[model samples]
Target: MAYCAIAVIVVLMSCFFNRFRPLGKMLVIIALLLPQLSKAQKTVAPLVLNNEQLPVLPKEFYVAAVTDERDDRSAVAWLLPTTEATSITPQYKVDIKYGAQAAIKQFVNYAIPPDKALRPVIVRIKKLKLAESLLAGGRVEGKMEVALSFDLKRAYDNVHLIDYRTSSIYNRIEGQQYDVETLLRHTLEAGLIYFNTWINREADTNIKLAKGVKLIFTDYTEQPEGDTIYYSAKRPLRWEDFKAVPIGGKYEASVLPSIGYNERVEIINGIVNIHLAIKTYLPKSASWVRNGSSTNYSLNHEQRHFDIVKIIAERFKQKLMSEKLPVDNYDGYINVDYLEAFREMNIMQDQYDNETSHGTNSYAQQQWNEKIDKELGK
Candidate 1:
């Protein structure tokens, strides 16, 4: 209105001065209209997405951040249709008040309060667009589309949990712009409600939401008929299993054995279940007997070395089963326990060799054999 008034005054003055200087009047009119033309060509007014229209609900997640990732970040909507009248035609750009990210953050917070004691999630606004088309009988049709992805925020990273996308079409009298906000608000509400329902249904079973850890230990018993002998009460080591050439040592015979485990991890009902396959084994190629010294007593001494490895493996399982393991670092804890068990095995092997004098002392050797058999539950 102010511009119109200024134009009218300028035109009146130009007419009054036309006879005195015609070029001056034309220049004054052009000068007066240029500013108005510039203002019209500038960006159109922005539409505010009011959050009050969004209805609150019981939600399982709170919005941590809202990111606008649309290809055309200049505007969230286009209010005016072009003369070509096609869905892809460019129109007057209309932006959300403040910005899309800020406005959506407000909208989500209004619907699901920030103070809610719930899971924290980031919302990626992949698409948020409103377009209008001129319809017959002086009416207009509007389409609003929204695509969003939800991510769970962990300590150092984020996990993509779910995605939501929806589009709505509505009809309104030409120039009735309020429908845009209504549709947008309903779309956002629908997204939030969908997520709430999804989480309620999936919270118990989704691996991404698992909160605790569990362990299931299984003894590895699948041994093929081969040179490697896995420890079993039914399959005691025999002298033939010692096939390696004896190294020049004071001991009559020697055996090489160790303990190890393989782990398989799974998440069920929001718990991380670690399945461990524990094994104690010896390879015939690594165990040897000296010539003319493969007596039952010497063999028993070597077998005790293998038995000590089995005992340590059992102890390793017990150590883990008796304690609560943290979900985030359970592997590290298992490794520490394994290293400790390995060290214990070496110490016990050395002690047995020293006390029995490498099977030389019959009384001490008998005492050691009894201790090994008792521990092995013979």
Candidate 2:
């Protein structure tokens, strides 16, 4: 028994040492090499732009922007035009004709010729070179083009329902000498990030489907007879070519639902005179107002409204696809899609009323019931 115990102890020790010897060696090596490896791995992505690096853009880019010295004490600039000016409702031919001409003339300082009066003005602009100075600190030179093109607003429903009350310039409106420059930098950074995010999402979707979607930034512009800005994929877009247009929020011109076949376009001072043809649809049923207090919950509710709408749209589309229904089945229901969309919209509204307002199902339910009754009657 003593001999057997000694032999078993020796065997256990041998096995333990054999297993731990390599592990100990690996730990020692890792402890010795980790810092060096980390140092070696410190590298930057090639496409990333440093603070001082200038972006390469085309030379012929022309940028048109608006300035409000009071709002942010900075100038407002956009790759797109002013949203407010385009919101001019034109239900009549005279309004459509003269309104468009007036808008174009205000910005471009040119008359929309009677013969070419009906064509949407299209423009394209890009950057020429980097503008470096004590102020800019050797940043990418800002450049862009203003184009006027198609007014598809006339073809789509709800063109005038919301009334393009949201007027904003793409540039920051602070009066500092570097305000515009700063605005340009911010716009470029934000725009690139946004596009990259969109690309990433598209890539993920494509990979799952075993397909790909290639989208390049281009400065494509289209303007027909009057004042139209048409952009396409063929044009090369520079970092400064795309301008950010704020569509909604506090101090917005108006909130309008973008309806079928129509999109309201805005440029800094560009002309796009189209009329609102449809009557505005009031929320008679959904008594859910935006959260009154400026708390995070209120903000969350507003954001949730947007998020929920997107989710509902996706779900509806998925349903349609699963049923093998053509996208055209609801073509006739474009105007009425508002009704269907609101079906899910109320969920967020209810959440807002409950969580944000802390209302005991009083105001929200009452308002919601009214909206429902109105819709049902219609």
Candidate 3:
């Protein structure tokens, strides 16, 4: 009896050990792979290009990037790394494939997948040896093997694009072979440029697509104490305020006289509540100064611009308060009034600068300052 019991115990122990052994090995393998696989799990964001460095993209077209965000439209794309880069880049270069998405969207609107965007445009690259015979003069010859494939199901109905693996691409530079980073960047820029050009030619017969502004909708929630609601009359302007970057031209100082607002439309107690506000700001990010010689004088000119914006905003507020607005179409109604007020502000601003000659005309500047003060009081 004792020998039989021992034999049964041995068999049970061996089975238990066999199960735990594989589990232990799996844990070890997972520990080893955790770091190596981290990059695969991480998401790459859209590429930020220096607008100055970018060549003029096809007139209105853009390259868009696929993101984790829920897209209501089709044809979004992501970039992936399929092979080890022989190129010396710490990171890959990619753009928002907006132009491609836009082109695809025109054709495959409802057919696109609802749960996720299209397949990633995979990029793979490797290096090649230098030519046996080199050009004696200034030319240095180099070559590279590259392949790319973008899913056209994104462009077509249930059609997969080319195979990145089988697609053979060769690029040779007459100059010296560049580092992996430069090579990758050059390839990306060139590839996107060519892709955009092709899409323009064939993608749509929708009467030639023209680039336009994309609309973004913001959501709002109720807060107890503090919320961002800018009211023009409630806020005023100040000097010694250095904000706003000067770009696009050579100027000493610029006053960004602007208006911005948000609205919260909610139902409370079976009644519709629309909370809207418009106000002006003097921000330091977009304004700039080239010289301090005329700082005080230039500041006054900028102040007038703000004052003009304030005047327009106040008038806009009053206009809204007095009118009977329809709940369903309230947004459109408000925007029409808001845009009209801004158009008037623009005309006034142009007149202010033209009459003052950007503050060169001392007489006109003083007269305008007094007029603005009187209107601000009203």
lDDT of each: 0.80, 0.29, 0.48
Tens-place lDDT per residue, model 3, 3-49, is 36545655555667666775555455555655545544332333222
Q: Is candidate 2 or candidate 3 better by lDDT?
A: 3
Model 3, which residues run further than 4 Å from truth?
1-240, 243-251
Q: How well does each candidate superpose onto the true structure, as a TM-score?
A: 0.66, 0.19, 0.37
Per-residue lDDT of candidate 2, residues 225-291 (tens digit): 1222122223212212112343444421111111112323221222222121222121112212332
Model 1, span 1-378: residue lDDT tens:
545866786777677775767667576767877765555533356666676533445545778889898898898777653222444445777787888899889888877777447778899999999877777776667788899998987776688899999988877664344455667777888998888789878877776766778889887776465877888878888999999998986888888899998899887877888999998989899988888987887888888888899989989988999888766567889999999999999999899889988779889989988888898783
User: What are the C-alpha RMSDs, in order, of all predicted structures?
Assistant: 7.9, 35.7, 26.4
Q: Name model 1 segments beyond 4 Å from true.
A: 1-46, 50-60, 81-90, 114-117, 133-142, 169-178, 222-228, 232-236, 240-252, 284-286, 311-378
Q: Candidate 1 vs. truth: CA RMSD?
A: 7.9
- Candidate 3's TM-score: 0.37
Ranking by TM-score: 1, 3, 2
